[model samples]
Target: MNITKNKFILLFLCLILLLIASFFLALSYGNAQIPLDSIADIVINHLVYGIKSNDENGALYDIIWLLRMPRIILAICVGAGLSVCGVVMQAIVKNPLADPYILGISSGASLGATAAVLLGIGSTLGENFIGISAFMGALGISFLVLFIANLGGPANSVKLLLAGMALSAICSAFSSFIVYFANNMEGIQTITYWLMGSLAGANWPLLSKLVPLILICIFLLWSQAKILNLMLLGDDTAITLGYNLQIYRQSYLLITSLMIGTIVYASGVLGFVGLLIPHLVRMLIGTDHKYLIPVSALIGASFLIVCDLCCRIILPRAELPIGLLISLIGAPTFIYMMIRKTYSFGSK
Candidate 1:
């Protein structure tokens, strides 16, 4: 036990180092390449010494600071948030295939975003009305799923999963309906791109709000690691151990909903990260949520940073959507994992 714990501690340290390296590496690559030292200097000067960019270095500074930094930060937050949520959701459902969006949050957010963009449903809100609408939609559908699941009795994994699937299908249909009938081609195009997901819209002001929220959610989930471990042993077993998993499952769903809603609002719907990262971590470190959550968070953060970097450099002039890149990488990788006979959900 001590040896295993030591190994995980070492792994955690290494992952933290990897995340830091990925951050710098991502900062250096873009449309206009900035050298590593220059990137470091600019970051240190701006953050430490409180220096602002001047004429000669202003363009580079803007690229690194104003644009790339926020995008990368958002990528980290979204990736970490989704990965942690994935861990919790899978435990809640006791399903190896479960993901953060298993509760229909992504589809609901997409529906709300589609309505805002195509039909101007939330135009009266503010500059970020679309995001606001998406957040509300995600949260609303999550509660609806809970309510439906709890109709006959306490919600269970099967009931929650079924409710989520039904609501997801409904939301997707509504979003498609809105998109198809909308006369605005521009709005339609915007919706298409937004749904594909991009970090281009990331900004400091947004991150200022989102970063804290994501960190808090991740921390809260980590604090529930013991309960999550109990969740894996089946509800009856948990009940025998004096833990009622019903309330815990509902609470976890709500927490993940908020985390995912914020992610969708900031970067649209970047799928597969949530589903992929947690499993990958579990494969390496077994089913212990104490180690699983933090490791998954770091790996997810680094993975998305690299993916975002690829999006910027993949095309000569134009960038690919981060979501598209993630799917391309994640789908094939996941298939390989599925085919591997050695891999099992809770195996050490």
Candidate 2:
């Protein structure tokens, strides 16, 4: 017991250090290549002394503080949120393949975004039309999935997964229909980039707004770690032990949707962080939600920050899409893990 506990503590500390180091690595390795010392100086002077980096108007300071900071922070928030959600969804559905997007939320958000960009559907909602539409679409799909699952029976994992797959297909079909009929070349280009996911739209206002939501959701999730463990025993076993997963499942789905919507708003349709991070963490820590949730959050945040750094510097003149970059890396890693038979996808 002591040995296992100590390993957990050690790995947790490493995750913290890795996150901090990756933050600086992200800040320093962009196109203009700000030095580590300069990046630290700018951040400390502005944050500790209540000074704005832009006040002195150095381009490097401005770039680091103004441009890179928001993107990096948003990346961390989105990564952590998605990774934690991935863990929760897999637990709820009792399926390793379940991800944050399993319930069609991503497709719903994409459909909303396509409508806003091509048909100008949300034009009256002011400048943030696309984001607002996407949020509503994701939230709506979550509710629809829950509703469908609850139709004829007490919504179990199998029903929920099936409902999600069905809704996801419908949403994707709608998105394609709109894209085909609209014939708006410019909007199609925009949707293409947005679908591939970019942190370019990140800003101070959006990051500040999402900070509390992300932090609160993660805390609530961590608090529920004990019950999540009980859930893995299957419904009958959990019920015999006096834990009803129904209310918990619905509540988790709703709360997680907020985080998902926030990410879809800030970054757009980035995948794999949710699916990949939890599996990696579980391979090391076993199935303890106590260790899994927080570690997954930390690793997820670090992974995205580091990946986004690669996206930015991989090309001299243009940045790679983050979604594509992550998919390229994550797909093979997951395949290798599956092939190794080290971590079965919920199979005992």
Worst 10-residue lDDT window for candidate 1 reads 339-348
TM-score of each: 0.97, 0.96
Error of 1 at 309 (Å): 0.1
Please report how far candidate 1 places residue 75 from its true position, in Å: 0.8
1-348 per-residue lDDT for model 1 (tens digits): 212888988998999999999998889887888898888888898989998698878988999999999999999998899899999998988888889888898899999999999889899999888888898899999999999999999999989999999999999999988888889999988888988999999999999999999998899999998999888888888888999999999999999999998888888888899899987887788788888899999999999999999999989999999889899999999988878735455322
User: Model 2: how far is 326 from its true place, Å?
Assistant: 0.5
Measured by C-alpha RMSD in angstroms, how accurate is candidate 1?
A: 1.7
Q: Report residue 171 deviation for candidate 2 (angstroms).
A: 0.6
**lDDT string, candidate 2, 72-169, tens digits:** 99989999999999999999899988899998999989988998999998889988788888888899999999999999988988899999999999
- The superposed Cα distance between candidate 1 and the true structure at residue 200, in angstroms, equals 0.6
Query: Against the correct fold, how does model 2 do in TM-score?
Result: 0.96
Tell me how far the alpha carbon of residue 334 in candidate 2 is from the true structure, in angstroms, after superposition. 0.7
